[model samples]
Target chain A: MMRLITSGAGALLGGLMMLAGVTGPAAAQGTGSATLDAVKTRGQVLCGMSGSVPGFSLPDSQGVMRGLDADTCRAVTAAALGDAAKVKFVATTTQNRFTALQSGEVDMLSRSTTWTLGREGNLGLMFAWVNYYDGTGFLVKKSSGVKAAKEMDGATICVQPGTSTELAINDYYRLNKMKFTPILIQDQAEIQGAFLSGRCDAYSTDASALATFRFSQGPKADELLLLPDIISKEPLGAVVRKGDDKWFDVVRWTFAAMITAEEKGITQANVESFLTSTDPDIRRLLGIEGDMGKALGLDNKWAFNVIKAVGNLGEMWDRNITPMGVPRGINNLWTKGGLQYAPPLR
Target chain B: MADTHADPRMSSARSSPKRSMSFAWSDPAFRAIVWQVLIVGVVVGVIWYLISNTANNLAARRIATGFGFMDRIAGIPIGESMIPYNPAEHTYGRALLIGVLNTLKVAVIGVVLATLLGTVIGIGRLSKNWLVAKITAFYVETIRDIPLLLQLLFWYTLLQGLPSPKQALRIGDAVFLTNRGLKLPLLVWEWQHTMVLATLAVGLVGVFLWSKHAKQRQDATGVRPATWPIGCGLLIALPAIVGIVLGAPLEIELPVLRGFNFQGGLTISPEYFALLLGLVVYTAGYIAEIVRSGIEAVARGQWEAAGALGLRSGMVLRLIVLPQALRVIIPPMTSQYLNLTKNSSLAVAIGFQDIVSIANTTLNQTGQAIEGIAVIMAVYLTISLSISLFMNWYNAHIALVER
Candidate 1:
């Protein structure tokens, strides 16, 4: 009986698949050509992003998207099409981000997604660059007197389901030989609400996100404390479908140019003036000396366009994340004892 | 008409020429066969194209396709599980099974409670007392209108707003209601509890056999045997006597306040509490309506006849109204059962680790969208099919017979 029913269902799905194939021939066109060619033909860069994090990809009061993830999308568009504003941001959750990219639903993903071995090795995605250096942290009420995560033994923690941070919390608690209960909530708003209402002893997520939520929605930022102990390393970066090295390099270098511009003291306001600089490295990056832009099949002013549109990495950070009270600690340039070092422009 | 009737031979000769050289298109069987062939051909063609397209796309994108990831360690923690699960030790497959068990737990409990509550409310809707009838009507009207997901969210939020654990509402130090959960004292069992459990199972089987024998004797001798007392003695009293004789080994583990929360009791987390309350409350409304209509489907003459024959109201309902009304209720009730099972998937929204939610997490972590969704689909299909088969069998047994 089960076999009969399953076969009937299979046949029905086949009929539907046939109908879909006949009616929508254009759906297969993405596979017929390269993603770069498709994006150029479409005249817009389709950028996948996490759309609700406060300082990551949330929309502003004017309905325009702002944040680090959103700026990354604009940077890609600026480099590829020489028009930073000509990009469409498709909001994705942790669940569907990779599928969306692999299925040609989006050109590239700029969500603050963590780069991991499974994702890069077996999941067929390549991390372009580590745009943000983040780690998991715990959020507890100030009155709880939980100075660090080790003190959070026997505490009930609320963490978002299906994220790396959820695992990190379990690992932290288990390794410490402490028994703790977990409340796994999905929506960000619900988790924050639960934490605020004292349904859980603490909320756990990326440290920057914890800061974003604490400052944005709370009993007041001072009433809540973000524990100083960073447990697991979460290198959040942009991801793209593998097997497209050309598109990968374009994205990777766009990130590199931003960091290098910040290290060279080239602010967005001062980017255009560097075209006449005597430094060969600056000239090569600005597309005034070398064939770097030609090598990537982009225009000579691709890096310049990215800088002009989203500004240097420092300016991007100072504008979007600084207001949320997230200090640029490990996210600082390599010369300042930080992990964010861009490759040499040459 | 007179001319055509008079010239029958001429009409027959004229139709003979048309019939002798008829086209195959005029044959209905031929037309049906041709259309069927065309549709099947088109379907096969499309399936082939889609399969190749997907294969090419997956290859081009380098997305791995297999079920090997199921064995990988699922590092994510589950809030509540019926089976033993450790995030460090368990595989993703085990986590998903735990999720399936949790889903079943909610679905089975929800179905039983909803049926009982619905039947009571449904009978109340037909009550002679104006207040009882009107209140039931109001309940059905109010509950059926609000969306279930919103109701679930409301319940979760309401539960979360209760006092913290330290200031929890306590009853006799055994039950505590806090924002964290409802803590209730649970049985802490020793070795003798197993003997009690085994004795109870044996007693239940004995009760079933006794009832069957009683029915058979009544049929043969035309004298109905009283089986209720015998059933109570076997199923309940027998087990209780034996358990007590063996020294009644169950001990209560009452909840006590620890530093931040209650410990040493059976805790029903807010997510499970909210999900159960929402599912039961929402589904009871529909069930109530079903029950009301099912009872009404019985003819008024049956009730009147049963009452006139000296049967009491309870006996009349049990012997006449229910037997017939059930035939109408069973089919729709089966659908409601399926709906409740499917709706339990919404547990993910409230942070309940149902099969769908866990599969989604696995999908997200492993980046295996197709395989994860396939597992969900297969599990739901099995559940839905099993429920349908059981209900269908029951419906067949209770189906009306014509002599």
Candidate 2:
């Protein structure tokens, strides 16, 4: 009887594997190729993201998914599917993010994932564009009598494991020859608890995350200070499975469109106005007088739809992250002395 | 009448073979074989399909699949490890081995301590004192009810909440607890320590043989002899004598508060402590219940008969009840040990740098997910099998002997 049951289960799993074999390769091409065609036929973009990062992915006061990462997903869907709401956000964790992407559980990952050459080659994925540039920093209580990360010799630092932040912490300590103990935690909640309970002398993570965490601390916001140390450059970006050049192009250009829209003063509210404007660059970008979207196998009005639906990159950041007190420093457009620059639509 | 009965029986016997042959499909062996073949075929087919699909998918996406990536430099630093590991210098394989060693260190220590602590609590749960029983019960209930992850988090939080190293809670001139970790005296080894250690190992072997000989003599002569004193003499006194002959084996390396934190001492990081404590406390609860049931399963008549035979309560417990109870306890106890080992995987969640966490970082850095997972599963499976084999041997030795 046991053997029979085992065999039966084996058969079912086998059948599933067979089905996966038929669909897997095509799915791996992602939503911009065969997978995208499939998605269009099915009518929804599978978006993977973290559901808990407050200013990046969490729901808003109205119980709607409202965050920077969430908006990025919306922007992609709006561009490709002609509707900002045509997306399914699958909440993922650090442990399952790659597998979720590899297995075609989601078409794209908008999670706060750091892009590295190793992940690009190894995880069978390609990063589309860097959405956020982050760096490791430390948060210490004002009473700790330590003003800088260098002063934290032999201090207990609380850090989340299984992320780039862990490596950054080690590098910072080793480079400075600073002896410190690490209290490694697995989740954000534990890191928060450990730091808040005074278990760790300092908490280390991306500066943006630290800022968001500080703002979320409510009344205790003023009691802690983030040290002016940027240990590692963390370029977080959207990613698709590797080998789908067409899909990669679409996702990359979609981001560029948002940035270009912002640079051209094309707000969501004023996107329609630019559609009729005599500006040739604006006309080309809005697909009012060019075949750019068609070249990527998308509708000509793809960028126009994205701008009208999700607004520009600046608007997305301000809506989702600005309230969290993260300044638009390096994230601002190149015209505003930031690093954001988009290629010409023409 | 005799002729008619014989003729009918002969006819039925002639047809019996034919009938049995027709019913071969219902035979258990035949059914089992058929089921096995069917299942195996389906499973293999499915696996082939999935493999091909994944291959196609990777090929289509241009994602390379192989373990070649493990050779690449990890380029990530591990926080704590038993062996020195430089990510820039070490391959992923080396980093993973370090992780495995760290995991084993925690598992070995945790298993020993948790068993000792759990056995005490298990016994306490059956104590005569209501307060003792209730408190043990409460401890088991509370710890078991909460998720190990949450408990780990709590312990980590509690450890971090300790005062800074400069203002660490110091005990006399030795032990200290700070936000960094708990620091205790380190043992300063001397050349004579090798002699002492050799003597201890020899003494231990001598004590085991002596106890066996003593037990055999008692069985033969029907004269009970005290084994504890003799065993202690061989195990402890012999070691001590050897140490004296060698002029003291070692000296304590007292931890002193240096410029910032204690400089020369063995420190237990808060992460390791949290993971260990959480695993032990959670596993102990299930172990307590197992002990309770095993003790209860020993027939009351056995205890009564032992008492009637002039055996004292302690003697009856040791000579009769315990031996019987062990038969029921060993199997479940082995499972609990396995559970504890697996639960140590949660160490990654709290930053204990166990095999899983290290493997994850290795996978991330090297992009060798398949190889990384294989390493983790193999290490854990080996640990599990070895523990079960050891327990099975122990169980077999104590098995019942029937006339």
lDDT tens readout by residue for model 1, A1-346: 1222222233234333433333122332432326666777889999998778989899999999999999999998999899988999987666666766766668899887888898887678999998789999988999887898888777888887768887778888779877678887676677788899998999889998889988886458899999999999999999988877778888999999998898888888989889889999889889998988888878888899999999999898998899998889989998998888887877
DockQ of each: 0.42, 0.36
Q: Which predicted model would earn the best lDDT?
A: 1
TM-score of each: 0.91, 0.88
The interface RMSD values of the models, given in order, are 5.8, 6.1
Candidate 1 vs. true structure, TM-score: 0.91
Scored by CA lDDT, what does every candidate get?
0.84, 0.79
Tens digits of per-residue lDDT for model 2, B296-333: 89999999999999999999999999999999998999
What candidate 1 gets wrong by more than 4 Å, as runs, is: A1-33, B1-38, B219-222
